[model samples]
Target chain A: MHIIEVTQLQKHFGDFKAVKGIDFFVEQDEVFGFLGPNGAGKTTTINMLTGLARPTAGTIQIAGHDGIREIKKVQRIIGIVPDESNLYDDMSGYENLVFCASLYGIKKQEREKRARQLLKQFTLDDTGSRPFKAYSKGMKRKLTIAAGIIHNPTILFLDEPTTGIDVESARQIRTMIRSLNNQGTTIFLTTHYIEDAERLCDRIGFIVEGRIIKVEETQSLLQEAQREHIVEFKVEHLDEGVIQEFLQSFNQIQVPRISDQTIRISSGRPIELMPYMEFLTSHNSKVLEAKLVHPSLEEVFVHITGVEIDRLKKEKEGKK
Target chain B: MNYRLMAYGNILKKDMQNYYLKPPNLSWGIIFPISWTLMFFLRSGSDVDIKAILPGVMALSILFGTTSMLSVTITFERKSRSFERLLLSPISLNLLMLAKTTGAIIFGIINAFIPVLFASFFVDLGGIQWTLLFSGVVLIAVTSTFLGLFIAVSVNEVFEAQTFSNFFRFPMVFLCGLFIPLEQLPRVLRPLSYLFPLTYGADILKFSVNHQASINRIVSFAILLLYAVGLFLVSTHNIKKRWIY
Candidate 1:
């Protein structure tokens, strides 16, 4: 079932169009990833869907409620975990969770019970009594997510859930997202990390500069990515001259300069490794290691959105 | 309706814990009243009767306590993005904002009494009208709290909130007939004094404590109530216009 159906949604900030009349739908119990570069209107689109930003023009129907008109009804069934941790700094983890549950009209006893359960589920039981301001980045993120789900919302909107957390915490959060999806919570996720989309999202949408370029099943996108053959060669004594010579010799393939001592060649057709290996060896470029590169969602994102990989990497660095 | 009430109560309780019960705010609540009372005596000299300045002291206490509490709490939460959590809740914006301001209102009311408590030790309290005093205190607290909410919503940073609050607070302290009577002011400034809601609030406290007021008692209460409602409506409008986007 289509739990969320947005049509020609638009959000304008003065002359800049943040979300320019885009359309999309999310199915019940499916994890949908909205992937884009920074300033690509990913957060703007989520804000519109969640009723934080009123659209300049469009229609949004969530769980049969008009997103703009009956927003309170829509809000009742949805959970939002903003990019920042928005829980109270003075309150404890348990207090924050219980307080969030109360906002959803949960009974006091039930809210306390649920808060305890969520603290345990998020592995925050040990630190439940500690103030949120004292929590580490990962624990703060965990508590914020727990607060969002305190009411057991039918759909959860997570914006950059794992952006700045530790590796272990990010992995645990991913596991929890999977578990929540398994238990029939529809997830609408927006993320900077393409790998997160590949691992957790069933279907992915690529939004760039306020326009959604493509939305497709993850498996299908990966299949399209598989059509291209790629190989990375780690070498010594490599330079711009050697790269030029290699590209000139192998005119059928495109060699992207990986580094001074490494190069990656990709093409639509299968690459003949022996000739390229022999040519590099004759040029005094020692090929230390060569490996076949399997395309992932990162490659698919680049291919579909046409955004530079360096730009995305720069966004990660800037966020960190 | 029941669910909304529950939501309101929860928001109120949480804000009370977060912004009101903290040691700084608790100390502030106690200290502001004492300081204002002491300042009144120092400015007017020790021989000035405490009863004559009780209304001004109470009004100033409520104003400073409420505005100071809200200036920090609201702006800090907004900066931290915690206010967005309340904005996204299932309750109506009106209810959520009212719940957020209720703590400050209560704090202001309590702050008003600390001065009165100090006065009762020194003055004979038999003839004072308790009902009128309570009504005046509640109105002053509500109006002052809504004024703080107005200032808080207008600014983004806590320091900006403090600065902006002073832009209103210090002006009202002088112009609202808190320390100076309206008739004693220049004729031009008397009209200007009437522009401030605190003017009506101070007048009400005066009528309650001294049985003397420049404006009629009914008009003072009505005007004070109107200002409270007006400030609240404008603040909520600001939130919808600026904060939501």
Candidate 2:
């Protein structure tokens, strides 16, 4: 069963179309990543799904209820951890959690118990009495996530949960996310962190310019990248002219370049490394190391999105 | 309905604990009114009727406390994005507004009563009718709170909310018969005074203190109730329209 189903979901902000008719569904207990650059409508889509923003056009069904008409039903089943840690600043961490629980209609005693459990689980037990505004960025993020799950929601929407935090805290949050998925909660996460998506998402949808360019299983997407084979050879006393001449002789090899005694070759098909090694050795060059380089998820994303990962990363940082 | 009520209670409790209980807010709501009443007593010559002005002081307290507190609380939450959490909850919007307005109303009533309590030490309270006074205070508090909600939801920033509140509040203070008798006002401004909810509250209080109401008690109650309901609907509608993106 799909926990979230969005069809032709669109959102327009005045003259700009933020999310232009995107469609996707997240299966039950799946960690679905929505990947995009800044201002690419990833947040707009999440807002529509979570009922924080009205869709200009399209339909959304969350856990068997119409996302618009039956929003209360959807709200009861879904927990949203917004990109901002927006709990009441004046309230203590424990108070924020209990308040969130109370909003979900948890009984007073149960709210207290659940709040305590979440604070401990988030490694915030010692700081539960501290006002939220006094918390460090990492602590606030942890507390926000804890509050999101205070009622044990069936589905959790985490928007850039690991962004702008200490490395240790980000790792801890990732572990918590994996654990939550293991406990049968459907996770819909939107992030600019390619590694987080590659590691946590069962499947990822690449969105660019308010459109989903592709959605595929993580492994499948990586496997599809195998169409291009890259082999890098390090040679002692390398002669660039001779290597270029030899590489030029093979029409199948494309974009071969020598940099600092290392010859990199790209081919549509897997190259026979034995012939390349023999060619280098015969040319008064000693082959030191040769290794095949498999494309990373970051590479696959760059290739699919037609944008450099660094450029996108810069854009995300600039937005922050 | 019950779940919504639970959400309302939770919101009200949280607001009270976080915003209303703060020292600055406490002083503004309670101490400010008492201080203002004392100022009035000090300035009043022997010819001034202290008993006649008591209700007006109480009405002013409700006005200032309810409008300022609600505006500040809403603006703070909205700026911090904490208010978004309330919107994301399963509770009905109406219930959320009710909870917020009701919190302000409770604080406003307490604010109004504090001055009265202080006044009783210096002024005789025997002539006042307790039932009429209580009812009028409740109605005024509710109306003022609803107005505060309307202003808060309409504006985006704390300063804007306060400015808008003042735009409404200062005019009401001058025209609501709080200081000047309604009949003493010029013919043109008399109708304008009736437009302010504070006018009815002042009228009710004047009658309660003097034991002779110029306006029928039933009529005053009904008009104030109507104002409360109308303002409540407008504020809730504005919240729904403006809150979501």
Candidate 3:
């Protein structure tokens, strides 16, 4: 049975469609990722599933429980690390975790034990007497995650778990999530970190403009990524512009500094590679070292979305 | 039903824990009202009828201390999106509001009665009707909490809520018959005092303290209850409509 399911889910804030008819499912232990650029409705979708946001239309079911009609049952088994930690700055990391555990009706002694265990697992300082305000951003993020799992929920909803965290903290969180999935916990995560998603998620759904434009296994998505064939030539101290002209025959190019008159041109399909190579030979362009590199997840995202993820993000900010 | 009760319990715990964890806020919440009681004691000495001022003081506690705290704190949570986190916790909004409002009730009573300890030394504390005082405390707490709920729902920011509560709190402190009787005000203004829930709250509380359970006091009690319950529902409803998808 599907451990999680969302069908035709939609939500709108006034005139703006925050989520537009998205559908997907997660197995009992799969780490499913909802990947998108900022403002692409990843959070909106997770919010709806977490029962923080009500869907304007369609249905969301968690373990056969309707998110709208049977939310309490759903909440009972889901631990959510919201996009923002929202932990009380006045409370210690230990207090924050134990406090959340208490809300689930865990006894204080049990909560204390669990909190200690979690802090140790997350490599947090055992002396958590200091206020959360004193913690570094990574420390706070780890504390929030610990707070989320204190109840030992069956499914976890993580919203951009590493957005503001450092690379080291992000890696630790990813490792923890993998261990949780191995223990039979289903995780539905949303993140802007394409590489993190590529590395950790079993399947990724690219959300574009409040819609799921694409969803596939990470390896498949990478395989489907638009190819950029690179052609290069080495010369006996020729002008850099001359090689640039040969490289210009292709659409996109990764330009590197030249001391030995060598240029690498990044372009479209393998067919485009032949023309650029032939043009180089015809023009007496001495090609040094050139080869194609597999596209990165970021590049794959840019290819599928028809806009560079970075540029699209900038445009989204401009619109906002 | 258990879920609701538990949710209420959790909400109350959250607020109490928050206040206890913050020393500055805890001290500020208690100081103003306690100071007011000390001032009264210094003037009246042992001869003063402390019970006479209990009703008015209770109203004052709700207004400046409880209502202000509720509005400001809830608005702070709303701004931080913490309220949304709670709402998303799969708990009923009604239960959550009930818990929070109950916290307000508890806070209002403590803030109001914390002065009683200092005043008891100067006045005949044993002779006062504990039942009457308790009634006054309940009314004060319920009224302030509902008013705070309304403010929290209407205001977008904590500062805005503070400003808005001031518009009610400052007037209620004086003209709402908390410290001054409605009879002391002009007849024209006497009718206007009814517009403030604390005025009716103070009136009923004071009358209850005197052991004179008049029909007018009952009317005032009904009016106070209606405002509290009515505003509580309205605010909770609007919050759901405002934030829920």
| DockQ of predicted candidate 1 | 0.76
Count of backbone clashes, every candidate in sequence: 0, 0, 5
Clashing pairs in 1: none
Candidate 2 error regions (>4 Å): A229-294, B212-214
Docking class of 2: medium
**Candidate 3, A256: how far from true, in Å?**
20
lDDT of 3 by residue, A1-320 (tens): 68888889898888999888988887788889887767888888887888767899999889888888898788878999887777777778887777677667676688899988998999986657778889888888888888888889999989878877788988999999999989988889887677778888888888888888887888877765545553444544456566567446543555432334554444554634556556656776655545665667766676555555446456534532
lDDT of 1 by residue, A261-298 (tens): 76777789988789878988999998999999898888
lDDT of each: 0.89, 0.86, 0.75
The complex in candidate 3 yields a DockQ of 0.39
Compare candidates 2 and 3 on TM-score and give the better one. Answer: 2
Q: Using lDDT, give the best candidate's number.
A: 1
Candidate 2 residue-wise lDDT, A18-60, digit = tens: 9999989999999999988777899889888887888999999
The all-Cα superposition gives candidate 1 an RMSD in Å to the true structure of: 2.9
Which candidate gets the maximum TM-score versus the true structure? 1
Q: Residue A103's C-alpha lDDT in candidate 3?
A: 63
Off by over 4 Å in 1: A232-265, A272-291
Docking class of 1: medium
**True interface contacts reproduced by each model, as a fraction?**
0.75, 0.78, 0.32
